[model samples]
Target chain A: MKKETLILVTNDDGITAPGIRNLIEAVRPLGKVVVVAPDSPQSGKGHAITLGSPLRLNQVDIFEGIEAWTCSGTPVDCVKLARDKILGRRPDICVSGINHGANHSINIIYSGTMSAAMEAAIEGIPSVGFSFLNYAYDADFTVPRQVAQEVTKKMLETALPPHSLFNVNIPDVPLENYKGIRVARQANAKWKEEFDERRDPHGKKYYWLTGEFSNQDFGNDTDVWALENGYTSLVPVQFDLTDYRLKEKLEKEWQFQ
Target chain B: MKKETLILVTNDDGITAPGIRNLIEAVRPLGKVVVVAPDSPQSGKGHAITLGSPLRLNQVDIFEGIEAWTCSGTPVDCVKLARDKILGRRPDICVSGINHGANHSINIIYSGTMSAAMEAAIEGIPSVGFSFLNYAYDADFTVPRQVAQEVTKKMLETALPPHSLFNVNIPDVPLENYKGIRVARQANAKWKEEFDERRDPHGKKYYWLTGEFSNQDFGNDTDVWALENGYTSLVPVQFDLTDYRLKEKLEKEWQFQ
Candidate 1:
């Protein structure tokens, strides 16, 4: 008999979030599932790892019949500990999130959800990060759950290139209005940040980060365009950040003395 | 008369670290330098931003005749806060680090030093993140300072492409043995992680993250090769994580339902 597929599930929204629970329900039938995630919310943590302190990992009885562990660290740290301590062997595939908010465009760099999946991809595990457009606690997971099932099935059957992962974002629409997935590129976009400056109770000034995401690229083949057009966007992501086109130009023309 | 160039400086190392002090010194002659950095070390913070808490920024009289501010946040947060609140304008260039350890290859993904520079690049500023192989607090800044001066001058003189940044790593060799800088790609490398599991006084188990740097790629044009061969490596990095080649193949071949 063929060995059972091992699936590692995690998220940046903490272990108890409805999103991860919905994700678990989506993929549980396809493989033997194990979960290791952060104990608390770690939304915009990016690729951060805990370096200055020891991490606490305890097995929790959260999901019925599923081995779940909670970690006191960043989303990336949970992946590291999961691989080094909990799993002790590489899983067939790793899936992170069903995150509470969208992680499209430039949000990937600030997203703990995508970073956890990216970390797994870096470790040679085929990975995918899922996000829904809704940010509410009671956001509908029906469409996201279906997307997760379809994407997860495809991933297990397909052979992805090494060190690559998928960033999948679902539009906030009813099942009837949801368009199929689109393969797209990351859009040229950014957050227009503003600091909401205010005084503390002690009269000391402090600032809260706030921003408006602005998509500057009008290309229809971009992730932002796809998401806005009521489709789920699936962008193939890579970890090698080298700008080869510019690297060649510099190598040939520029001089460093 | 030409308007003076404005340079924003920051690092993952705390505001008072010798690394940032040396960096400020290196670029002090190039332009009007403004320093905004973290109040505590945030070495592996990656691209994290402050979301859950308010940020504290305090003006400090650390460097004589130079204006500097200390922020109670990550390195990337300093860059954002610098642009929106402190500087209230875009700087000509943003430079981060003279970091006390190597941030070459896979280290870039976990580095607060590079993330700060990347944050600036995403905002249309030409930027460079510098790291030396030495991890000692008292590491010699002789060669690094000179390198910073040369690179900063070159960046100001050249018209770089938009939304790109440089990751420059120097070898720990003596100045006499230091080879000139070489433009290279990020090497395929990862950490071989090991968890140091131990029991606390309460008999509860905790784990400390420890890892050994492992380089698997043997490319002569990679950053790892340059650093090992006693040369400074300059890798131009971009924020778009999209894998275009894979996307094209998937779009043409894969069936997503």
Candidate 2:
């Protein structure tokens, strides 16, 4: 008999969040599922790992009959601890998030959800991060759940390039209005950040980070375009951050002594 | 008269670290410098931002005459807060670190140093992240200081492509042994992680993250190779994580519905 496929599930949203629960339900049937995720929400944690402190990992009976562990660290830390301690061996595939909000465009860099998946990719595991457009606690996961199932199934069946992962974002639409998934590039866009400055009771100033994502890229093949057109965007992502074009340009034209 | 260049300085190392002080000194003569950095060390913070709570920014007099602020958040948060609240306008350039240790190869993704610079790049500012191979608190900054000066001068003189940043790693060598800078690519490498599990005073188990840098790629043009060969490696980096080749391959071969 063939060995059972091992699937590691995690998210930036706390393990108890409805999003990860939906993600777990979506991929549980595909393999022997194991979950190691943050005990609290770690949404904007990006690719952070806990370096200065020890991490706590305890098994929880949150997902019935599923081996689930809660970690007192960021999402990326959950992946690292899961691989080094809990799983003991690399899983067949790692899936992170049916995240509460969209992680499309430049949000991937600031997203703990995508960063967890990216960390798995760095470890040479085939991985994917799924995010829903809606940010509400009671946001409908019907569409995201189905999308996760499809993407997770395809990811398991397909042979992806090494050190690569997928960023999948589902549109907030009913099943009837759902457009098929589109293979797209990351759009050139950014958050127009504005710090909401307010004084505390002690009259000391504190600031809350707020931003509106402004997309200026008019490219039709970009993730923003796909998501705006009501399609679930699937952008193949990698960990190599080098800009080869600029490297080549500098090599030819610039004088470095 | 030409307008003074407003340079924003920051680091993963706290505002008081010798690394950030050397960085501030390196660029001080080149522009009107403003320093905004973490109040505590945030070494492996990557691209994390403070979201669940508000951030605190307080003015500091550690760097005499040079304006600086200490933020109660990660390195990336320093850049965001600086741009939106502290500076009230985008700085002409952003420079992060002369970090205490190497941020070459795969370290960039886990580096608070590089991520702070990356945050500036994402905001459309030209930026550079500098790291030395030394991990000592009192590591000699003479060489890295000179390197920062040369690179900053070149960066200010040239017209670089927008939305890109540089990751510069200096070899741990004295000035006499230093080879010139080489524009290199990020080496494909990863940390071979081992979790050191121990029982706490309360008899509860906790784990410390430990790892060894493992480099398998033997490419001569990689940053790892440059550092090993006694040269400072300068890699032009970008935030777009999309793997276009894989995206094209999946779009053509895989069936997604």
Candidate 3:
């Protein structure tokens, strides 16, 4: 007489992405699977919730046994809809993405994949967002599945800290030659952005947002370092954006009227 | 002769809101003001950047003496636009809001006001987002203006920590009654959300998002506690979401492959 593990699954790379397909195949064996994700790709959507318009949910059959639904909303909306309308009960664990790209360091702030997991974590559900270093349309995720399953299984056995969740990024490697997992902090990395200016058909100008990932932190404890050293990086990410040490410093040092 | 300070200004309640107008008035004397803000309201926008579509910009004469441009995008877009398109050089300081509502704790994650400031901080500009607890259209600005000026003046003189910005929340008190500013940490606070299900004009069920603020942390060191105590709260917020302590703990303790 034990409670069944209700795992709420989602992704930012759309429901049709092979990443989610791989994720669904992996997690289906462990729990009652409910796949609720965006009907189309919603990468880099951040922590956006659909408040300006009506969100529509369409019941779709993407995975064979999984009760799947595609949402015309962001990845966070999928979790919201699943919590409100789709899921019969509150899910025990929420797993978002086997995203087609890396969502490490500052990228996690702008990632719809991790945002979905953050949403679940906010609701006190244990969650993790999985991403691969590869950004290809058909990236190999065979190795990441084992990493995801291992982490997901561990979280299922023991609850994660409610204030935080995992942002897991796997290095781009074939399954046979994949390195092991590494628990590390997110690297102090950033995207050095440059907007590519281009002219449209109507002779107007537009910009394509482009950026280079810059990592200055040489710490071996970072997720970036782990990935570089041939390992699946697991960064414990949190929603609390406060810098506690700086707070005390400001209080003691700054002049206040 | 001192180098002319470059100040980048933006808001969440649209470029034309009374809040931003008041903000422009306050900062006009301090430096070379460059206003780049959303043409429309972008509340609860989180950290959204315009990636899918081409961003549009329109020059405006709203702020009289200031060089201003309206962006057909989110608040973050306005900051990015200002950095890439409008600004003659990198801004020395970035100031966001005079928002009519408080963005104290968990609210910072969903605030367009703070996101704009955070975007600037990511680009290495000394930045702060000012907000008042009053959520009315014509909330009292007498208090927020003073705090904003103080914080801005201080940041202009002294550089803030890289990748860090301030989340300044003023109390909804009269200027005379205010207890002054207090550097604090973001409280462990959240909204107790309850969806009000209503019938739309088309006889379809819809939900109006409604929530009540809940402050779980009672410590005086928190932003919420400072606001409640009639002190202007200044929390140094960082964009990096990594939980470093948990990383060490997981690495040493957790059973991982």
Candidate 2 residue runs with Cα over 4 Å from true position: none
lDDT of each residue in B1-257, candidate 2, tens digit only: 97889999999989989999999889999989999999999999998999889999999898888999999999998999999888977888999998999999999999999999999998889999999999999899998999999998899999888876999999999889899899999999999889899999999999999998899899999999999999999999988888989988988898876
Interface C-alpha RMSD per candidate, 1 decimal = 0.6, 0.8, 1.7
Docking class of 1: high
Write the residue-wise lDDT of candidate 1 on B168-203 in tens digits: 998999988999899999999999889899999999
Worst window of 10 by summed lDDT in candidate 3 chain B = B203-212
- Models sorted by lDDT, best on top: 1, 2, 3
- lDDT for position B86 in model 2: 83
List the global CA lDDT of all models: 0.94, 0.93, 0.84
Candidate 3 clashes between residue pairs 3 or more apart in a chain or in different chains: none
The sequence of per-residue lDDT tens digits that candidate 3 reaches over residues A68-150 is 99888889878877887778677989999999989987888888999899988887788899998888887767787888888
Better of 1 and 3 by lDDT: 1
**C-alpha positional error of residue A69 in candidate 2 after TM-score superposition, expressed in Å:** 0.3
Q: How close is candidate 1 at the interface, in terms of C-alpha RMSD after superposing the true interface residues?
A: 0.6
True-vs-predicted CA distance for residue A82, candidate 3, Å: 2.2
Name model 1 segments beyond 4 Å from true. Answer: none
Query: Which one wins on DockQ?
Result: 1
